[model samples]
Target: MEKYSTNAINADAPVMLATERLLLRQWQRRDLGPFADMNADPEVMRHFPAPLDTQQSNDLAARLCQLIARDGWGFWAVETRSHAEFIGFVGLRETKPDMPFGSCIEIGWRLAQAHWGKGYATEAARRALSFGFEVLALEEIVSFTALPNLRSQAVMQKLGMHRAPDDFDHPAVPQGHALRRHCLYRLARGAWQEQQP
Candidate 1:
């Protein structure tokens, strides 16, 4: 396994990964407001159970920052290079214990509703996958979403991840909730390397 420096990630520093149009960097104080707004938007949170309030959003951002600081990589705060606008986050995170895929890395993204339909999510995710396979030396990365969230599933397909036979109920969601059932997707490092030029 590849190891990253345990030194706390500095949010103010420039990111190590940069796509042509985006920069996946550490979280900054400025990101909280926009992240909170994004989390509170019903349209944006439609796949999840409910929209987050300001406090809940801030707490989530704080937890993400803490994870990055501890692990030296995580769901990085993503921004457009041209405008430096905080669109959302897209990167790799360790799957929570409650998830069926234990002790595995997963790629995920959440962007402001206004930023949807642009190629931003796909572009940023491609870069994140490279970091996972090349930099982190992970054997595989997985992604899952509420079965109804075809938009995210489309992005997963664009990244060349295949649908896995195992569909799981998200433990974080209520058992009978409509969003509890999630479609799982997986991409092996060899498969990812094959797609690269």
Candidate 2:
């Protein structure tokens, strides 16, 4: 049976997930500059709507922190355990403003160009799935990205998320926007556990 329970959910949850080469933790004030730089890079933001400015990056981080403060799990700042360099973030987020699943969460990730092809996103995303299914006991977790963002779609496939037929224009984005046409993928708790190595 799918293990979907909200009983373990709580705000004020601790952050800090460490892998062999990476550390996923809460966003720090000092990390904002580099984070902003990443978000502002056209190459990095190519799949996004547009490059974000410093204030926008700060606001986004603040909002993510607040979400974690309220819901117990949110995007995590990803860094190298060896050098402690902030490369990107990965975690779970609620689908907002005309969400497909209605009161459901999704797993997502973003990485700097310098960190691309390094498998950091896939590695961190795997851990995030562990937290969602094994720890949080979430029933299902979904991920969505622009139809053209095949890199992200590849990562989702690597993490074992199956594509859904329904394509929705993201309400938060303007209609006819390139980023608005999104393809969704989903993985149920039982399927996730079954696919584990």
Candidate 3:
């Protein structure tokens, strides 16, 4: 998936964005431990195929940096501002053409098991969406999850995205697999701006 050049405003001084409880920022070398710990959780990987090891986590960090440099958008290392501890990641990615949709960018999040249900995903996602449209001037942003992933779907809804029923099976996942089938939800730039409080 090739991400388009973004006009998203650079975070002044790279200062982190603070939600009610979370902080979104660039990944740090120290983030590897917590990131690996989160990826090693089986329940967290349940929605996907498998948990990643340390080497995978390290590689992912490097890869994410490249993506951020190239597209000005990538998964942000998320933590708690109060505690200043690493929790997980939340941000955006280019929607693969293989994915079931038109040209799109996807908003996504993943938190450690301990951080689940803390509203971190929704809060951080709201900030990312703001950066995308209000700053990047994106035409649209979308999100998707497996048919069984009601939790993620709820988060998308909370961010004001509406379900787009014309979905297709994810080619990345094997056919007949539980996670292959997905549902897409989208929010246009105008619609998202109007929903701003």
Scored by lDDT, the top model is 1
The 10-residue segment of model 1 with minimum total lDDT is: 2-11
Model 3 lDDT at residue 186: 90
> What ranking of all candidate models by TM-score puts the best one first?
1, 2, 3
**Winner by TM-score between candidate 3 and candidate 2:** 2
lDDT by residue for model 2 (129-195), tens: 9988877788899999988999999999999999998987777778888788889899998999899
Error of 2 at 115 (Å): 0.3
Give each model a TM-score: 0.92, 0.92, 0.89
Candidate 3 colliding pairs, count: 0
lDDT of 1 by residue, 98-191 (tens): 7887768899999999999999999999998988877777789999999999999999999999999989899999989999999999999999
Model 2: ten consecutive residues of lowest lDDT: 1-10
- Superposed by TM-score, candidate 3 places the C-alpha of residue 156 at a distance from the truth, in angstroms, of 0.5
Arranged by lDDT, best first? 1, 2, 3
Give each model's whole-structure lDDT. 0.89, 0.85, 0.81
Model 2 TM-score (2 dp): 0.92
lDDT of 3: 0.81
In model 2, where do residues sit more than 4 Å from their true spots? 1-10
Please give the distance, in angstroms, between residue 121's alpha carbon in candidate 1 and its true position after superposition. 0.5
